[model samples]
Target: MAYGLSEEEAVSSISLSPCEIMGIEKDYGSIEKGKKASFFVSKGNALDMMTNQVTLISIDGVVQSTSNFQYELYLKYRKKDTTN
Candidate 1:
């Protein structure tokens, strides 16, 4: 069996390999020809950046806003709590 389900599956149960998903098996899901840039780099686990802080995030070559919704709310309440 070329595929099954396990921790190594990496969320492939409903789909083909990353190369197939992106439709660039020969040029993408790796470094090669005219492949649009994708993916991200985080200070720690990439997923953690969603809850933690993200130094930077670029999607489709455009940088994302650094303003974090949760962090902003925390700051808003933290200031209120301290003042109170």
Candidate 2:
């Protein structure tokens, strides 16, 4: 995941580096520490653009919303109109 990203871009591109820099990294990004834990729970490989499906989610020791978590919702509802 830390492959093609520049320093600042990498930090800003994902919710990890910044969280770490702010000393909150222990409680966020990847699996570690006393963090409550959260996950997209994709059905397929996270690197595969075509197979990415965030089927389940957990946030802040709880599950808030699955079908409307912004990114997942976009992937779920925003299909390109190829009817033409």
Candidate 3:
């Protein structure tokens, strides 16, 4: 974005553009028939670190768990009364 690319182009630079360079655009970049259904769902803008919150992810047309060790630990610890 700082380089003057539009929001769409900036997003493509990280998604479609890379796949095109890797010669995997035919099966990886851009959602289309016959292409791999791999992507993530975020609650907010994916480009903004502060607002980016990935809630779901799918790979090769399969939904995946978003839970991880860190997230599990956060949930466990956050449930405790730290003020005590």
Best by TM-score: 3
Cα misplacement distance, residue 34 of candidate 2 (Å) = 1.5
> Candidate 3 residues 1-84, lDDT tens each?
658888899889988999999999999978899999999999999887889999989999999999999989999999898786
| TM-score, predicted candidate 1 vs. hidden true structure | 0.47
Number of clashing pairs per prediction, in order:
0, 0, 0
TM-score of every model versus the real structure: 0.47, 0.53, 0.90
Of candidates 3 and 2, the better by TM-score: 3
lDDT of each: 0.55, 0.69, 0.91
Which has the higher lDDT value, candidate number 2 or candidate number 3?
3
* Candidate 2, superposed: residue stretches over 4 Å from native: 1-15, 68-84
Q: Report the C-alpha displacement of residue 50, candidate 2, in angstroms.
A: 1.0
Ranking by lDDT: 3, 2, 1
Which order, best to worst by TM-score? 3, 2, 1
- Per-residue error at 29 for model 1, in Å? 3.4
For candidate 2, list the clashing residue pairs, or say none: none
Model 3: pairs clashing at backbone N, Cα or C within 3 Å: none
